[model samples]
Target chain A: MTRSVPVRVHRDLARAITAIENGYASFGDTLATLPARENGKASFVVGVTGPPGAGKSTLVDRLIEKFRAGGETVAVIAVDPSSPFTHGAVLGDRVRMQRHSGDTGVFIRSMASRESGGGLAPTTHDATALAAHAGFDVILVETVGVGQVELEIVAVADVVAVVTVPALGDSVQTIKAGLTEIADLFVVNMADRPGASRTALDLKHMVRESGRDVAVLQTIASEGTGIDDVMVALTAARASESSNAGRAVRFEVVRNIRDAAVRRALAVLDAPRGRSVLERLRAGELTRLEAREELLVYALAEVINAD
Target chain B: MPIKVLVAKPGLDGHDRGAKIVARALRDAGMEVVYTGLHQTPEMIVTAAVQEDVDVIGVSILSGAHMTVFPRIMKLLEERGVDDICVIGGGVIQENDVPKLKVLGVREIFDADATTQNLIDGIERVVAEFGRARKRTGAATPAS
Candidate 1:
């Protein structure tokens, strides 16, 4: 593997991330060459996620200020949804954080969630790892506006802050399964709105009932109000042993294995030998399930033989 | 795998209608467009381009600061030792200043008469040129 770019250089770090985003053939080698964290202190990754129009970006912008003021080098990975049809995206998350553009202590990258259903771009993990390797003390990952089940943030961040706004109608929206389970802290951003206290209270009550130690903080992110408390809560959350630590590694390994298997299976299906099974199915000589099993067998054989 | 372009409105121009339209058109044409909203400084724009590692930057300057803005951006990119990212300009520029801006290493200047298709085609062309340059020197070497 050729390691041409120095991973610690800012310019080279940007290039390394681009290589990962574009799936350059040797990007893994570049990542592999990055020095491991010293003293077991890797960059702290904070995942900020919420529904559309929840001010996730605005809150992230404020948090970036708070983190930077503490003198930590911060890197942000903001992901936006790609058009399922065109695979293109208009990444506007940086508009709110544009003030930090010239600040050398900050590095922000926008990514389009192409073919990744997880609210994050496919290469977000790789990019975050590269940023950590580049020696950032904090990495803030802002996911695409999410709904109930974009729980992939749990697999990446040391702390997951789920930002929600007030007057979301039914308070039941707050207790939904996937999001509530993953949140280490809940931020009622845009807290100046009408139902701010009520929303916060509901969340607090829900957390109490669930017997979880989750902290709920309120903030009008646009005004930079209540941000300090939110930051404090985040610090506390980070101090706690994350339940996702072991699960995250296992999740990544499983995902990688799944991706590789899918690739190999596709390769087998595209080849003549595997296509014959499809032909048999098409000719009514084999059932769909039978053909699928035959293809899986071929794919498994290919995977085993390659070893 | 996709072409990434940064569309920014630099200077005091509040007129982002043109910039937004171009960004939307680019996105619809299968390009990832980063729209950095209004009144961005040249420094901010370049910082964004470098951090985003965008293949091209489309600066929309209707503030008549083209003479000041284009040169500053070009100089900044040069100072940063970044040549791979292409810079293009659009919106309310006098026809006579087109060649002048191009001389400053602005890849292409699209005026009012230039349609969305023209802008898109021009961007794709310049991005392809940069891609070829990168290929020739190897991807690790910055395109000179």
Candidate 2:
């Protein structure tokens, strides 16, 4: 690739975001400069995720309105699934919040979940950091919300709200197995619809049975009902910082190291040895466990040696 | 980086089937499409483009107001000094109006009958051209 003249970005918010997006050489230095807590307030990150068509966007739209009403500046990072072939994604989350379009108090950015496991874009943490550094009081990271495996939001978000709808098969098992453990709040959105209460009740029962104190809230996001309650719950979650601070810190640190290694590991996995291991497994010459062990050893050695 | 296109339906066009179709097509073609939901004005579209930092602004107008809408959008882009962003139009346009719309700074006007492939190809070409121009001028590349 030919090198072009460097373009200067004036605003720190834009500069940090562009640097992370482009993976510029200065990204690490730029990230290091951002203050963890700005303006005496540790910026709160709230993650809203659930299966697709669960009204996550609408829920986020309402949450933004509520946050803004409380005199808080809000920044939204909507993570959408990327196309496997071209690594592109349709970022339509802003369409749901058109009323907030020209409002200077709110900033909405749509991000593609580019090659990152757990339904988050690799740049999500950097973007949230920028939003915090720019003095946004509340930063909402909305996940791709594809399925169970997209639980990476918990690693970055201070509060993780899983928004689920009625009629998703075996809701109890799905929630109990995956979403239950990580969710700071479980929301049964579109609560006005049929069977909404049933879903909420089931979730409430599951929460009780699991021995965790996570809140289960019901919401009709389009109508803007139950939004205030959700906000109140999130405020409480944010206030109880000491409880989750250690976990959050560990998550951030481990992810910071793992993210860089994962990118390189992926590159190695696409190389010749990785292909041969996969072919062996497919041909029944090697068991899945054996192939995984071998590939892990090779990739781990490569990463460790590089360091 | 994927190309970002803002699909705006300007005016009181309640019919958004075309806009939705085109937005999905652009997404399927490996480009990000920001659909400014229906009933947008020229000002709203331009403001969206500026905020979203899109490379292409595609206006879907079926309210027979292309002549008024396209010029106003172009004027807003000029006023903001964001003339580098490519403009395209579609929906309920008369055959002869294409020339006038083009004169008003619309790079290409696709008719309602234009296939999704045609829209995709036209957008890719325009976005590529705009990118080259931006690079030559050293403008900060639009966010993908």
Candidate 3:
């Protein structure tokens, strides 16, 4: 690990970081070079997901403001849809979160979808690590949790808060749909609306039916209402499950082991013969099962030769 | 090895699934991605870029900070003598701002609707262009 990398490497690194910053898919060698921060040093990973126009972004802004007010630094990762055709991310979702426009304590990243799929994105994990290393106390992840995507924040966050509003459309035919049980806390924002109380009542009824121990709270992020209680409930949840954060310590260990194995395999298998085998697989001369078996044998033989 | 790229989030724009997916896509495409995490000031992104010596710098921003932040990166790299680096940006950029970004030395500007293939193509195109320039000018191609 040299302090001064070659200038071309610098150029490549710059282009890669700029790619992610601008919502494009960056190279993976770029991600691998991100030095891993020490384990168990993770911040409080909290997720906020809800329907479109449910004021999820506003609520996230409120939470981040509060945390920073308490002298806590915050990191926010907002995930938006990518252009399937162009494979780039048009991350307009981050515009709604202008409340913390200039605050130094808040680090917001708008992720554009272009390259990959499924779960909280890997760059999000890297951002979490970077924030932890920078000594942020909390990381707030907000996803476009609409359209049947079951909780992208759940895997990434220690606590997941599902934001829901009253009259979430299509209630005429069905009762249970959208961000329901996956929410650790059910927030009924826009509490200023007329049916707000009724919506809370209905939500309570639904929660009772679902048999999940979710805390339901009321909030009007526009007017700054009931956020304290939401925080209290969230703090209570974290206080109850300090062990979940502890699990990240174990997660990092597994990641390290996987990395070691992959590197070992790559180092041994980087030969002319090994590459020809891959070409055979790509050409469909070998089935994937056969290819895997062959690679295992090849990898072991290569390792022995290198030794 | 596929070309290495680093994606960074500077200022305050907390939205990352797209960056992660792109990183994964590049990985699947046989390239390596090093994500610098979020809240990167221009200095951190540039420092990491120089240290990692990546083939590309992919910056993702949606916070309207692009106008102020992206240019700052260009300036920083210029000061650090790494202006040959290919810079690209994608996110909720206005249709009008594309030219300004290019004028600022950003090689490509993809909007929110771009697919992974477009990004991979952009990286290759930009990298190849730089490779040609390096060859013509007798500058070294980036060493692995």
Estimated TM-score for each candidate: 0.90, 0.84, 0.53
Clash number by candidate, in order? 0, 0, 73
The TM-scores of chain A alone, one per candidate, are: 0.86, 0.84, 0.65
lDDT of 2 by residue, B1-144 (tens): 677788898878777887888878888888878776888877677767765667788888888988898888889778765656899888889998888877777899888789999999998888776653444242233333
Docking class of 2: acceptable
Per-residue lDDT of model 2, residues A47-109, tens digit only: 999988899999999998888878888878888888888766777887898887656677777
Writing each residue's lDDT as its tens digit, candidate 1 over A101-208 gives 767888888999998888998889888988887778899999999988887887789888999898885668767788888888899888878999999999998899
- Stronger candidate by DockQ (2 vs 3): 2
Model 2 preserves the real interface contacts to a fraction of: 0.30
Candidates in descending DockQ order: 1, 2, 3
Off by over 4 Å in 3: A1-41, A98-101, A114-119, A169-178, A242-307, B1-144
Tell me the tens digit of each residue's lDDT in model 3 across A80-100.
555455443334444455445
DockQ of each: 0.52, 0.31, 0.10
Docking class of 1: medium
